[model samples]
Target: MNASPEDPLSQRPSRIRVDLDRLSHNLRSIRAHVGVPVMGIVKANAYGHGLVPVARHIQAQGVEQLGVAFLEEGIVLRQAGITLPILVMGGIFGRQAVQFIEHDLEVTVSSLDKLRQIEAAAEALGRKAVIHLKIDTGMERIGVHSYSAAPFIEAAVASRWCELKGIYSHLACADDPGSPMTLQQLERFQEACAHFERIGAPMPLRHLANSGGILHFPQTHLDMVRPGIMLYGVLPDPVSRRTVDVKPVLSLTSQVIYFKVVKAGNPVSYGATWAPTRNTRVVTVPIGYGDGYPRGLSSRGQVLIRGHAYPVVGRVCMDQFMVDIGDDSAWNEDEVVLIGEQGDAAITVESLAQAAGMSAYEVLVGLNLRIPREYRYS
Candidate 1:
């Protein structure tokens, strides 16, 4: 059951399965929920689900735009023949402006000074740079503070070389519906947008909602919505309400490569962490921290096998980990479920994040390039 017949690489014990249909369903669901154009967040290698493939799948599904955290990510999409509008939201330096313009990627204008740098580059190239104004509402991260956004907005509007495309801000607490910070930030964003009216300039598109905002606050869905982790069927916060019915698009499964009977009181794995009080059956899974599976999950994580959940018995190794099955029977080449379902039991990314003492975002992006990913339309 661990092997994929459609994929030759599935023969490898450790592999990732991405359901493009699930991704497509999530994109449509998010758009229907927000009633606005969707900005699919495909950064962090599409949250470890493979960037180019996810981008291509989503782009064909009619998402209005794509958002990435870096210039190189946007360029990669373009190189892969992605033609949808892409905004590099990671905030750019004065130097990265040239590549942004050359690749037809959108720039995030945070300050008058930063705007000027990009303006100069666009002017030199004889191409007006398309840009989005990022206002610092309350995140206090990047962007012009809402209190002083007037001057920055004015300068961007007056710039001859930069074409202001959209104005947006990142939500810091929209994930927590009980947090007052989101409303305050939204108010600040609204006040900042009012500057266009004050100056009698055309208002650019407004977007402030992230995945949390999309689920919790409808008012934040102005001109567009950006669904990051949620687009991949994961919640920003485990407690966040699931307003949209989105299914997970990624699954990590492997085959049991080894089986043995560990004698009572015999320690296992690195650090000689734990041993069974009685003789127990154990199996080795061919994935570990080296594959971006968190080592912190050692002895704490659970995996599904043969329709039952088994605890990881000891410290996870760089390339392998052991699981205790007690009196149950298992054999070599049996399917091992890490972040997916087996029978009625499921190991979700949220549950994995909780067990690993990490955020769902981190857990997804942490599954680095070591594992090969195969896409499934079914």
Candidate 2:
């Protein structure tokens, strides 16, 4: 069924359906595989699957904690009445540390200065600020350098108002089990942990495995594991797909709102990039780059209609695109599958990413909020 006529989602021609049961199953599978507390990564609007709903669902499934990229994201979850421990995994501005304390959000300490700011914020609030110290094993995007992490760890340990809750480092290449860099980063993180132990500092909860690490490097699963994409049933890397058993949890779909026949030699859409070689039937779907469908897929994209594959034969516009359905007669409101299975055919996120010259992460998170997400539990 497309949608009931009274359903608000049906009012929009395009929507993303999220299977929460599949999400829960993925979480169970991941937790079983890692045998550790899972800190569900719900950042980027739960990788564009819907943040609060996803977070609430994961929490209900017994997730010990949640991770978000920014303090505001954490605050949003808090405002939604989520009481689960949430860690803000992004870099923090010194002035914003108080919000972390006030909201009871765990802060990520990447530098000594940020640590002091958090300490002061906690002191002023008459509360303790829980934090995870991020060490730069690789990815160089954030976190203190592992070799130079002692001072930061020492400061965190010494702080009266800041509680060192955990220590973590991001993996740069855990997706490729064959890459020695992951092992190298693991060693560096271990050395940093040893430094903490040698200083007689309380060793905080240690975690280093992301989705890729959780699937490929079992040893990296320490006190806990932070999984993002895999929890949504998408592999962190294509190679990991062979090693893990999970289902895709999201499907982008739209309804065919208009259909017409194009005479041979007539151009299809803007820029005149494609023309029908023979008189054929074409259908317009109410989805485009404006809906986070990649514009790059313009002429290269494919969609499923009536269980048949149809090529997206024109430049993807701001709000609509056309597909050549051959000579088959199509009518308004015909179901179109953009990133899901239809009969024997399927178009996956990975395939769409390849067509758009982007990553699966990009394709998932790039899904604009304009497309309402409808939840399903079966």
What lDDT tens digits, residue by residue, belong to model 2 across residues 178-207? 889999999999999998779987789999
Our tally of clashes for model 2 stands at 0
lDDT of each: 0.92, 0.90
Best by TM-score: 1
- Over 4 Å off in model 2, which ranges? 1-10
Q: Which candidate leads the pack in lDDT?
A: 1
Model 1: residues with Cα > 4 Å off, grouped in runs: 1-11
The TM-score of candidate 2 is: 0.96
197-283, model 1: which lDDT tens digit per residue? Answer: 999999999999999999999999999999999999999997799999999999999889999999999999988889899999999
Q: Which consecutive 10 residues in model 1 have the weakest lDDT in total?
A: 1-10
